[model samples]
Target: MQRLDATDNAKALVRQLAETHGDLMFYQAGGCCEGTQPQCFEKGGFFPRTNDVCIGTVEGYEFWVDKDLFEYWKHAHFTLDVTDGFGAGGFSLETPLGKTFQVHYRVFAEEELEKLPPVKRNIP
Candidate 1:
């Protein structure tokens, strides 16, 4: 019932990253360029905005969505996915390895919405 999930490839990549970096996290912003994609970082590496939304976790790693984006996608499900490419102007851990993180989303069904997982509305 989580708002966030990850693809097999994403999970594997994050696993490898966590092994090397200790822990990992993600943030998806909203905008025309860099904000459109997801960014991966070593846990605690990036400072989230105060009002960022913690959508959920992938492989136990927290995944946060920008406050503005979360408002637009509050009823959708998000899945973390990865693709081969350099990341858009970001400091994401995967950027240096010729890969970038992406987010795929879908609307939550009526039934699914009834038991949707909780989200942290702000970083606090």
Candidate 2:
């Protein structure tokens, strides 16, 4: 099963972004002004460290999370969502469009945990 997903609105936004930006990627920020928010960028805009985890894909774009943050959130499933405003850091591509990416999470069920897909830690 996939660990990450996106809302209809978010998918649409990604499509819009890809049309203009070519390709995209997402990284779940750990802290600082970004405040654990999901930031979207041109595929190579923000590099994923070796220890960062690629939980899954959303709209065909890799969705990665910080290693320590991933450890803290290991039991949860994430859904990427979009909202109609600016995020704190304003570093995400959507921020310029007056939108921001957000993540909604739910703890995995016992059965789900058993079948959950393995996360990729090696950055490609």
Candidate 3:
């Protein structure tokens, strides 16, 4: 496993979220319109992906991202900020690498994640 350095701002941001919201899982998935797929996850159980990497933990919550995906984003500079209008869920990260990548955080209900298709892969 590779070691990832979450900026002090990033660590603090994640810790705050976990403390407010019970447990948070980190993973990568398709992005919203005009957004680079980000390392995201809802609050629930998740199957491991081939390239997934568990970088470290924050406030007892595991933080991870697909190794390959993380490498792709390693060079993208990010900024963390907080906002109001959401229930302890306004944390967001902005990348200087343009809108190609989109990172988002939201309160996810357990039932909502059950509807996602199971992860599958085929190697030639």
Candidate 4:
């Protein structure tokens, strides 16, 4: 089982972004003002620090969650989605388009949990 997935709208947006920006990545925000919104950027734009957990990829772009935040959300399955309007921080690439990347979550089933793939982290 996967820790994360994406909605059709989100996948399409990624494709649109890739055509213009080349490559992309996502970092889930966890601090003040940013709340828990997912911030999208051109690949390598925002580097992942040690301890950041890479839940998985959304449309092939890595999706990382702050380690502290991941501890709180580890039990849930995250579904990346897009919506109209600006998210907490305007730093994400989508903000300029009047759209925001968000996550929909649900606790994983017992069987699914056992089969979930391991998450990657910046160990060094």
Top candidate on TM-score is: 4
Instruction: Compose the digit string of candidate 3's lDDT tens values, residues 42-114.
Output: 4565655665555444444555556565556543322322222222122222222121222433333456445
Cα lDDT of model 4 by residue, 11-106, tens digit: 998888888888899999689989999999999999988899999997788999999999999999999999999779899988888999899999
Winner of 2 and 3 under TM-score? 2
Q: What is the lDDT of residue 61 in candidate 2?
A: 89
Residue pairs in candidate 2 whose N, alpha carbon or C atoms collide under 3 angstroms:
none
RMSD of each: 1.5, 1.1, 13.4, 0.8
> What does the lDDT come to for candidate 1?
0.85
Per-model C-alpha lDDT, please?
0.85, 0.90, 0.42, 0.91
Cα lDDT, model 1, residue 64 = 82
Clashes of each: 0, 0, 3, 0
Tally clashing residue pairs in candidate 4.
0
Query: 1 or 2: which has the higher lDDT?
Result: 2
TM-score of each predicted structure versus truth: 0.90, 0.96, 0.40, 0.96
Q: Per-residue alpha-carbon lDDT of model 1 for 1-124, expressed as tens digits?
A: 7788889999999988888898888888897788678888888888789889998888898888888889899999988899999877567888878888888889999999999866787656
Across 1-124, the per-residue lDDT of candidate 2 in tens digits comes to 7788889999999999999998899999688878889999999899998889999987788998999899999999999999999888788899989998999999999899999978999665
By TM-score rank, best first, the candidates go: 4, 2, 1, 3
Model 1: lowest-lDDT 10 consecutive positions = 115-124
Instruction: Give the best candidate by lDDT.
Output: 4
Please list the residue runs of candidate 4 whose C-alpha ends up more than 4 Å from where it truly belongs after superposition: none
Residue-level error in angstroms, candidate 2, position 60: 1.0
